[model samples]
Target: MVVSPERLAGAPHPLLEGLDAGRAAAPAAVVIFGASGDLTSRKLMPALQALMARQQLAPGTSIVGVGRSDLDHEDFRARMRRAVEQAGDVDERAWAELEGGFRYVSGGYDDGTTYKVLDEVVGDLDRERGTAGNRLHYLSTPPGVFADVVRRLGEVGLHRPALGGEFARVVIEKPFGRDLASAEALDAALHEVLDEDQLYRIDHYLGKETVQNVLALRFANSIFEPVWNRRYVDSVQITVAESEGVGHRAGFYEEAGALRDIVQNHLLQVLALTAMEPPVSMSPQGIRDEKVKALGAVDLLDAAEVSAEVVRARYRGGWVGGAEVPGYLDEDGVAPDSRTETYVAMRLRIDNWRWAGVPFYLRTGKRLPKRMTEVALQFSGVPHLPFAPTQAAELGPNALVLRIQPDEGITLRFGAKVPGQSFDVRSVSMDFSYGAAFLEEAPEAYERLLLDALHGDPTLFIRTDEVRQAWRIVQPLLDAWADDPAPPVDYDAGTWGPEEADRLLAADGRRWRRP
Candidate 1:
């Protein structure tokens, strides 16, 4: 197992602590279902290359691309290499090491012939490359076909753990399902084919370094955890704002509006991470168990409360980041009368001892003011400010923000006395940047997650219960939106969300932090 100095630099994060943290991925057949898709070209290829560059993937491990495209192994490798090269400079030696094991099988996901062919290819790799029959199947295909892919693999006898305790695992991408019922059906289908332990439900947000650092900030450090509960924390804000419009994904965006697309997976996952109780240990199940519990504790809103608690809106044509963007309705392929929401803001109450009354405000929208993904905790104001009203008038509540992208870091806001001023106090932020703290830049989210998936570490991945619970929490809102006559409220692009969103906070005598 080779670990780049960049990853081993400084103190390792608490989440990264474990006996197997540095263990390389075992020799296995790494098969990707949608190997010709954009996710493969843009994300998966670069990530695999990075792992290869770091020598994290074991020598005998192989990648078998199973796609519908009619291309031989060499053509597939060339196409993927081009994408990896475009993403960044490739390590020629690592590329050579990885390229030899690359194979492609073109066939329909539902075709039994495809699985038989894939089985033969995998068997050959096991014998020739010493993969030892271990397999890691990544179902990168559309959610609609996930069950079929798994079932086909099962029919070909690829679902069972490989010989000699070598694992055979599958990774599935989300919108695990559109709603509660669909999610349950998908889970049942998957379970029928393979055990829960064999499936990895991936959400890239959980792979971010900052997102993982959240654990270190809470459980590893003593300062933050003490004030992390309802007694000291006033509110929690989780925002995943994107500056770009739907662009080429308007067709997909139309079907999975903000709630299903962002809220159900990314936002709720982050929320669970932020609010979850300290796990007894850093084991995969231990951490994921706490996350699932946190989501379960989120008070589900009734149909009646959905209207008041959740605000769904679409972005209208306007300037964003100084460039004009079209409205969601004007986006190509989007229906003119589409009620799909581009922005959603909701006030969630976690019904747990730790966060009983404290609100968790969640929001994610396309074409907002800027691209920012973060979780900010606003601590309650001081019990009593000793300074005169005029002295601390400008001071705001203390805040600890975990910035998940752009500039990945944490910022703690507090009040400070002004120098040479007469009894005046001002708010100040103390920042910790991942890039500055460590000499190396943090790996991209996909890179970290892909490495974890290959290593069979499911800590950063969503569990089955987590997915179903998230859908449960948001299902009422989904149904209410369907029954309502009015369309989603509209807000101009490049601005903050709709005015109604602001009022959502104002009604509680608080407001969202612009950051």
Candidate 2:
């Protein structure tokens, strides 16, 4: 069956619905630092290609790759071509169109001459390709060089837009800092070169179709909101688990651990979205303001509380996906005596009126039994059951689970009468899967975030205050963990996590959902 673009676009897909196909971005040049890095080939190039295929990119858009590699324009283009091909299938004409706009500048990040050359190259592209002097600089380099790249851009006048011209923006990758103080320092340095509006702190989680649908599932439907508060909700659990061990990120993971890498940014963002009040409007500031408020309401745990409420663990050698894998210490780049945590589970309380007494449980880890990310809200049981105790023994509290990955969907679990002469009730689920409900495939998270950066929409991107506030919420835990003399608890690679993780919820008279 031939499906029209209009039909496919307007279909009831969670991600594709309400997508504005006609919304055109202004002509701009994207300058990527460390363009030869894995992120560029694996994510950025493919995402840009996908955007081009959808006609979302403006005409005459250009891409400039900056790196220390000794590669000319054609070499970089060929490298990118292989990357895009590895990502997925590409139309020849689409590749050709994007290939035309590709350019390369080889230089060191610490050298001011590099930015000067970049300025000239960008200007030349502007004149030849009609890019209109608007630039979106992407710092795809390591955190150590982020400041250097930004300062160089400022020195070369690339951070400023042309007179009466379009805008200039920069997309910064995550791990904003090692801790609270460093995050503040990075923000200060960034503010010196660019205004807050010109900065886009990218957190890929916010761009997921399921993550964005969090807003729709709560606010768009009237029924869910009235009971969303602590009055009727029992608890909320957010889990991001990976079935595979850290393949080559051992060095990065050794320093970051699961808390700094995932919990501080991604899991916390999901928690805020799940608990935040409805925004006044859907504008970038409108949504972020509410998220900031929710994050600000999180109760900071003291050292004593941390010991009781938080669980940190490292993955020991065991089988995963039917294959035996080495432990974290066994990884190539990891230290044998490293105290880094591969898994973290914590119980949090939002001190706001909406969620005062309710607990928010969060957990994330690598080398788990499955790869899944979800937010589950368990509702309070009915106060008065009109049935016998035995008849309702199998019934459980109703839950609304929002599956963010794997099989993206929403599941509503409630009591359903078991078929018999008796009135016995059992838990049954009604699911809405993205694959089954929508014909259109969901766009990659990077594609959505990159397009937003080009269009100057900060809705999905983290703001300066949001970044600082997230750091603030996690600082106490980081401090406590740093001071503790005990090592992280150990769990087998293929297991869920440490036993302490289960005890975190067990202490509250509840348990985690296997999902």
Cα RMSD of all models vs. native, in order, equals 3.5, 4.0
Query: What's the CA error at residue 387 for candidate 2, in Å?
Result: 3.0
Supply candidate 2's per-residue lDDT for 285: 78
**CA lDDT, every prediction?**
0.88, 0.89
Off by over 4 Å in 2: 1-22
Model 1 lDDT tens row, 93-138: 8888888899999999999999999999998898888888889898
- Candidate 2, residues 1-515: lDDT per residue as tens digits? 34466864676433333333346678889999999999999999999988888878877889999989999999999999999999989768678778789999999998988988899999988888888889999999988888889888998889987554588899999989989999999988888999999999999999898999999898667699999999999999999999878789888888899999999999999998999999866778778999999999999998889989899999999999899999988888888789999999999999999999999999999999999999999999888999999999999889999999989999999999999899999899999999999999888999988998888888888998888889988898899999987889999999989898988888889998887
TM-score of 2: 0.96
Would you list the clashing residue pairs of candidate 1? none
Strongest candidate by lDDT? 2
Instruction: Give every collision pair in model 2.
Output: none
Q: What is the TM-score of each candidate against the true structure?
A: 0.96, 0.96
Error of 2 at 148 (Å): 1.0
